[model samples]
Target chain A: MSFFNALLEHTFLQHALFGGLLASLACGVIGSFVVVRRIGYMAGGIAHAILGGMGIAYFLGQQPMSGALISALIAAVIISRVSRVSKHGHHQEDTIISALWAVGMSIGIIFIAKTPGYNVDLMSYLFGNVLMISANDLLLIGLLDGGVLLFTLIYFKQLLALCYDPEFAGLRGIRIEWLNTLLLCMVAITVVILIQIVGLILVIAMLTLPAATARLHATTMLGMMILATALGMMITSGGLLISYNYDLPTGATTALSSGILYLVAALIPQRRHAVK
Target chain B: MPALITLKDVSFSYDDRPILDHVNLTINEHDFLGIVGPNGGGKSTLLKLILGLLTPSTGEISVFGKHPNQVRTRLGYVPQFATFDSAFPITVLDTVLQGRLGKTRSLLGYNKHDHAIAQRAMAETDVESLQKRAMTALSGGQRQRVLIARALACEPEILLLDEPTANIDPHHGESIYELLHRLHERITMILISHDVGFVSRSVTRVACLNRTLVCHATSPVDSDSINHLYSNPVSVIHHDTRLSLEDNL
Candidate 1:
C-alpha cells in the first residue's frame, strides 16, 4: 500500500524508476526497427560483443561504458561490412557475427584475466543492476533518448522507405550503405544504454519483446513505436516494482513482463487490418 | 534532342557470365519500350542499369543526357513483382506515399501537396479506393497497381518496371499492362518481361535481348528474329501460337 511512499522515500529507487522510463522510450523506438529489419541476431551479437569493450576498459582503468560503446560500434561496423561490403561473402553476416561474438567475449575474458588488479564486478555487467543506476548514467540515458528521438523524427519517412523498400529507396537517391551504417550505429547506442535495464544476456529480449508485442496490435511504424513505448514503460516499471517487492532480478522480471504480454497479444487473434 | 535514356555499347558481366553484351539502345520521351528475353538473358539487368543499380563493365549509359545517378529522382522504378514481401504492415497509401520521398524533404514530412500527388498517383493507377488497405491484405493485381501508384508518385518522366506481370493471374496481367498502356502516353516506360506474347501487344516497340540485343517494331517480331536472338533454333509462343525455344544451356 505504501509502495508510492517508498518510491518517494528512496532516491535510488526513484532513479531506477526514471531510468526504466528512459530505457522504455529508447528501446521501444529502437526495438521496432530491430525486429522489423530482422537484425535481432545482430543486436544479440553486438550485446555479447560489448563485453570485450568492458574488459578492455577495466584493463586500461578507463570508463567501461565508453569502452563497451566503442566496441559495440566496431562490432556493428564489422558485421555490416561482412554482410554488405564484402564482395563474395555478402550473405555470411551471421557467420562473421558468430565468429566475432565468440572472439569478442573470449577477448574480454582474457583481458580481464590479464588485468593485475581486476576487481570489477562482472555480475552487474552480466545481469544488469537497474537499481544501481547513477546520476551520470541517468543523464547519459536522457541524452541518448534525445538523440534517438531526433534521429527518428528527422528520418521517419526515409527510414520507412529504406526499411520497406530498400531498392526503391536507393533508386530515390537515398544512400543505402551510409544510412544502413548510421542505423546500425544508432542500434549500437541503444544496446549500450539498454544494458542497465536488462544486462548483456537479456538485452535482446528487452529490445525485441515489447516491440514484438506492440507489433501484434499496431499497423503503422509510428503506432508501433508509441504502443511499444507504452508497453515497455508498463513492463519495465511494473517489473521494477515487482522485483523490489518480491526480491527478484529486475532484468528478468522486466523481460518476463514483456514476454507474458507478448503471449497474451499473440493469443488474441489480431483484428482485421483496416486501411489507414 | 538527346534521348531520355541512352546506352552506348554497354556491356555487363558477372564473373565471366555475360548478361548484356555490347548493347546499345535509345529511349525517347513518351516511348513505350517492352523488353523481352529468355529467363537469364539480362532483361532485368537492363532495367537495373537504367535505374543506376548496376554499372556497365564497358561503355557508357545516360538518362536525361546525364549520368543515371544525376537523373534518378526524375525516374520512377518498379522492381520485379517477385521482390515484394507482402507480410509488411504498411498501408497502401503509406506505400504509395514512399514515392514522394524524393520531394518531401522537410521537417514536417509529406505536406498537403505531397498527399495530393500521392492520391492522384493512386487514382492514376486505379488504387484510390484501396489506399487505406493493408498492403498484405491486397490481391496480387491490387499490389501491382499500388506499386505503380508509388512509382507514379514520383511524377516521373521515365518509368521502368522489371516484371510487373510475373506470378499474377492472366486477367490481372492484362489489366496491369492495360493500366501501363494508359500511363505511358505521358511517361516513357521500359517494361522487362520474359513472356513475349503477353506483353508484346502493349508496347509500341520491342527489344529482344540474349547476350546481344535486337530492336523490332512490335508487328515484325517473327520466329526468324526469335531464332536468331535465342540460342536454341526453335519457335516462339506468342498470344496465339504455342512453341518452345529449346534451351541450349
Candidate 2:
C-alpha cells in the first residue's frame, strides 16, 4: 500500500496518467472508423512501418518520434494512393502495407546495428516510458486529440455515409474519394500518437480491439464510440497500475488486457443474428 | 416534356470487356422506368452510370440539364441488397440520417432538422418502429425498408433503385411495389429488375437490355416485343406426361 502511494505521488507517474488518457481518447475515437471500415490490418501495417522512420532518426542522432511521424506519414500516403489504383483493391493495400512493415523493421535493425555504443534506451520507445514524457509531448497529444475530435464532429454526417454505403454516398455527392483519403490520414495521425506508448507492434491492438469490444455491446455508432472510450480508459489506467506494481511493460499489459476484454465481450450472450 | 435524364451514346467497359454498349436513354419527370435483363446484361451498371458511380467511356450523360456528378445531390440511389455489410454497427435511425449528408455542411454535425427529416423518412417507409434497433438485427424485408428510408431521407428529385425487392419474401416484395407506386407521384424512379411481369405491371416505361439496350419506351408492353428485345426464343413448358406417352404409343 505504501509503495502504491509512493508511485501515485511521483511526478512521472502523473505524466504517464495524463499522456495515457490523451492517447486513449485519440485511439478510441479514430479507432471507431478503423474498425467500421475493416482497416484494422492496414493500421497495424502503418504502425510497424514507423520503425523505418525511427531508424533514420536514430542514425541522424535526432529524436526518433520526429522520424517515426514523417516516415509513418509517407508510408500512409503511399499506401492510400497505391490502394486506390491497385488491381486487387484492398487486398493489394494489405500486401503493400505488410511489405512496408518488413522493410521498416529491417531498416531500424540495421541502423541500431551501425550506431556506436547503443547508449540510448530503445526499450523506452518500444514499451513506452510515460515517466519520461515532456510538456511538448503532452501538448502534441492534446493537439492531436483536439484535431481528431473536431474532425469527427465536423464530418460526422459524411463519415457516417461513407461508412454505411459508399455507393449511395457517391450518388448523393458525399465526395467518397476525398473522405476516404481524409480517413486514412486520420488513421496515420492516430497511429503516430499511439506509437509513443504502445509501440508499433502493439498499437493497432489498442486501436482495433477496444472499438471491436464496444461494438459487441452497442447498437448505435455513438454508443460504440462511448463504450470504446470507456473501455480504453480502463485498460490504460489499469495497465499502468499493473505495470507499476509488477514491473511489466505498460504497452503489452494494456494491449493484452484490452484483447481479453474483447474476448469476454464476444462471449457474453444477449442476441446472436446473422449480419445482413 | 424534355427528358429529366439523358444518356447519349454512353458506353462502359471494365478492362477489355464491355458491360454497356452505346446505350442511349431518356427519362422524363415522374416516370417510373423499370429496366429488365438477364443475369449479366448490365442493368445494374446502367444505373451506376446514371448515378455517376461509374464514369461513361464514350458519351455524355446529363441529369436535370447538368452532368450527373454536378447534380448528384438531386439524385438518390438504393443499391443492390448485397452491397452493404449488415454487421456494421449502426442504428436504423443513424443509417437513415446518412441520406442527408449531401445537404449538410462538411464541418457541422447533424442538426435537429436533419434528425427530423430522417425520422420523417423512416415513418414514410414504415420503418419507424425499428429506429433504435441495430441494423443487423432486422429481417431482410426490414433491412430493405431501412435502406429505402435512407434513400428517401435525401429528398431527391429522382430515386434510383437496383433490385430493391430481389431477396425479400413475396409479401414484402408486393409491399415494396406498393410503396414505390405511392412514391411515384412525387419522385422520378428508375427500378432495375429481372422479373418481367413485376416490372411490366408496375412501371410506366420498360427497358429491356442484353449487353446493350434493345428497347425502352412507355409500357403495357407486348410479349412479342419483349421476345424480340431479348433476342431469345420464348418457350412455354407444359408439364404433361400424357403428351409424351401418347407420342410414344
Candidate 3:
C-alpha cells in the first residue's frame, strides 16, 4: 500500500499512467483490425520503419516522435500499396516487409553513430523510462487517442466490412482502397504514440497480443475492442508496477505480461462442444 | 422488358491470358440466373465483373442503367464460402448487420431501423437462433445462412451468390435453395454453381461458361445439350448420376 501510494504521488509516474492508458486504448482498438487482417508483420514493419524518421530527426536536432510519425506514415502507405500489388503471396509480402524493416533500422543506427557527444540514455528510448514522461507527451497521446477512437467509431461498419470481406465490401460500394490506406495511417499514428512507452521493438506485440487474446473470448467486434482495451490496461499498469518494484525495463516487462496473458487465455478450457 | 443488367461485348484478361472473351449478356428484374462452368473457366470472374469487383478490359457493363458501383446500394453479394476465413471473431448478428453498411449515413452509426432490418433478414434465413454465436463456431451451412442473411439485410434488388451450398449437407443445401426460391419473388438473383442439376432446377436461366460464353438459355434445358457443351469428354453416366435436370425441375 505504501509503495502504491508512493508511486501514485510522483508526477512523472502519473504522466506515465495516463500515457499508458491512452496508448493502450489506441493499440487495443486498432490492433484488433491488424490481427484480423493478418497484418501483424506489416505493423512490425511500420514500427521499425519509423526508425528512419527518428534518425532524420536526430540529425536535424528535432524531436524524434515527429520524424518517427512522418516516416512511419509514409512507410505505412508504401508498404500497404506494395503488399496489395505484389500479388505473389504471404511469403513475398513478409520478405518485402522484412527488407523495409532492415533498411529503416540501419538508417537510424548510422545517423545516431555520426552524432558527436551523443551519449544519451538509449535505454529510456528502447525500454521506456516511466520517470521521464512529460506533460506534453501525455497531452499529445490523449488527443491522438481521441482521434483514433473517433475515426474508428465513425468508420466502424466500413472497417468491419473491409476486414471481413474486402471483395464483397467493394461490391457493396465501400471504397476498399481508401479504407485500406486509412487503416494503415491509423496504425502508423498508433505506433508513433506508442513509441514513448513501449518503444519500437515491443509496440507490435503491444498492439497484437492483447487483441489476439481478447478475440478468443469476444463474440462481437465491439466486445473484442472493449476486452482488448481492458487487457492492454491491465498489462500496462501491472507491468509498470512490477518494473518499478524490480528495477526492470518497463516496455519489455509490459509486453511480456501481455504475452503471458495471451498464453493463459489460450490455455483456458474453451466450450468446444458448443461449436457446430 | 428492359434488362436490369446488361453486358455489352465484355472481355477480360489477367496477365495476358484471356479469361472472358467478347461476351454479352442480359438479366431482367426478378430473374434467377445460374452461372455454371468448369474450374478456371472464369465463372467467378464474370460475377466479379458484374458486381464491379473487377473492371472489364473491353466493352461496358451496367446494372439498372448505371455503373455497377454507382448502384451498389441496390446490390447484395455473398461470395464463395472458401473466400472467407470463418475464424474471424464476429457474431452472427454483427456479420448480418454489415449488409446495411452502405445505407447508414457516415459517422452517424447504425440506427434502430438497421438493427430491425438485420433481425428481419436473420429471421427470414432461419438463422435468428444463431445471432449471438461466434461465427467460427457455426457449421458450414449455418455460416452460409448467416452470410446470406448479411447480404439480404441490404434490402437489395439484386442478390449475388457464389457457390453458396458447396460444403453443406444435402439437406441444408436444399433448404438454402428453398429459402432463395422464396426470396426470388422480389429480387433478382445471380448464383454460381458447379452442381448443374441443382442450379437447373432452382434458376430461371442457365449460363454455361468455358473460358468464354458457351450457351445461356431458360431452363428445363436438355441434358444432352449441356453434356456436349463441356469441352472435355465426360461420361454421360457421370452427368446423369450427379445431375438430373428433368427430375430437379
Poorest 10 consecutive residues by lDDT, candidate 3 chain B: B236-245
Writing each residue's lDDT as its tens digit, candidate 3 over A1-276 gives 554796767887778787888888998899999989988889889999888888878878889878898998999998878877776344477788899999998998777767676545655655566557899888888888998998998888889989988877776677888889899999999988888888888888899999999888787778889999999899898888888888888889999999999999999976643454
**On a 0 to 1 DockQ scale, where is model 2?**
0.58
Query: What would the per-residue lDDT of candidate 1 be over residues A1-276, giving only the tens digit for each residue?
Result: 466889999999899999999989989998999988888999989999999999999899998889998999998887777768565543666777888889888888888878896476787888899999999999999998899889988888888888888899988888877888778888889999899887888898889999998887776888889999999999989998899889898988887888888999888876644432
Candidate 2 wrong stretches, greater than 4 Å: A1-3, A87-91, A117-119, A272-276, B105-107, B216-249
Ranking by DockQ: 3, 2, 1
**Residue pairs in candidate 2 whose N, alpha carbon or C atoms collide under 3 angstroms:** A154-B107
Candidate 3 lands at a TM-score of: 0.92
For model 1, what is the C-alpha lDDT against the true structure? 0.85
For every candidate, C-alpha RMSD to the true structure in Å? 3.8, 4.8, 2.8
- Candidate 1 residues lying further than 4 Å off, grouped into runs, are A1-5, A87-91, A116-118, A272-276, B227-249
lDDT of 1 at B138: 76
What's the best-to-worst order under lDDT?
1, 3, 2
Q: Determine the C-alpha RMSD for candidate 2 after optimal superposition of all C-alphas.
A: 4.8
DockQ of 3: 0.64
Q: Give per-residue CA lDDT, model 1, range B25-78, as digits (tens).
A: 999877899888888888888888887888989989998889998889998888
